[model samples]
Target: MDIYQICPEFKKGQITLRQTETQDAEELLNCYSDEAAVPLFNSDNCHGDDFYYTTLERMKQAIDFWDFSYKNRYFVRWTIIINDTEEIIGTIEMFHRIAEDEFNHFGILRIDLQSRFEKQEIINDILEIVNENLYQAFEVNSILTKAIPLAGERIQSLLNNGYSPMNKRFMGYDDYYRRNRVDN
Candidate 1:
């Protein structure tokens, strides 16, 4: 049930994954509040200051969810870390686990290391997480990602890695969203 402690560190030559503790508040705040994180989480229902507060509130909610049911929400989230310096630069999470719903059996989410490593390594980590974790539990393994416009080559890299745009047309709701995310 303890996803953070359950998995061993992310074994690169020297990098790793360690459990995030309450002491990490300041560091996580700094990372999540960065300019790079804003676009990845599209401003869904607010603007300017409201959206900013909403973002922080959303993070609080996530942390709360993580603590809500340690067992099921074990898939909730984890702070990404580098083993050498013991610095937590970012995070990865399950994002959602629709237990009673049939649609999203095992959802995936991750946000980590804007500058720590090349985007390809992040993609590789994502693949590794999926292959080792989620794929072990679900029949279908998928991700819910936001197509941030300014990701530049990063977006192309994700596509190259077998990730596709889910609602490319965005004309109608397929039981997921309220607004039809038409690329108009």
Candidate 2:
């Protein structure tokens, strides 16, 4: 896969879209070890051997997915690597025909960051990345993103960046997951 050809939009002069996968997962793990990633990815609440195994499992899945190309087709999920470190900071995934057509475009399926780096500048940079990879350099009207109640600030940042929140409700988490799209 020509992963290097995907133009990267920079963040803090380092993170971009062109980084190599060789160092992606390991570096991401260091950042993923932060307090923020606990609730999001550590759903199994792992420790020691369990943590190591789980992390390895995750890395394996990532490599497999990245290497799995369908006849030169670009997969919907794009890994966002940090500038200086070149590790995956987050993922911007796009799923087509989401949940019976509740929304479209890229939905930020997952955003794991070092809780210490939760600043507006970083937030806006991510928005720029989203705009760069999204349809028409802007999030489509039909495309909407949803966050947990606790992610208010992050959601606000997106709105401030011109992403409008649609007034829609869902009945279940699984249903939302089934329909969730990514805004990469």
Assess each prediction's global lDDT (C-alpha) against the native: 0.48, 0.46
TM-score (C-alpha) between model 2 and the true structure? 0.60
- Put down candidate 2 lDDT per residue, 129-163, tens digits, no spaces: 55555444333423334455455556666666666
Clashing pairs for model 2 are: 8-17, 14-83, 15-82, 15-83, 93-182, 106-182, 106-183, 107-181, 107-182, 107-183
lDDT of 1 by residue, 1-184 (tens): 3343364444543345554555655566656666655445433222342122235556565456555634554354566766667776666555444655433454544444444342665545554554455444333355544445565444665565556666442222221211111121
Instruction: Report the number of the highest-TM-score candidate.
Output: 1
Error of 2 at 28 (Å): 1.4
**TM-scores of the models, in the order given:** 0.61, 0.60
- Model 2, stretches more than 4 Å misplaced? 1-14, 19-22, 33-35, 38-53, 69-74, 84-88, 104-109, 137-141, 170-184
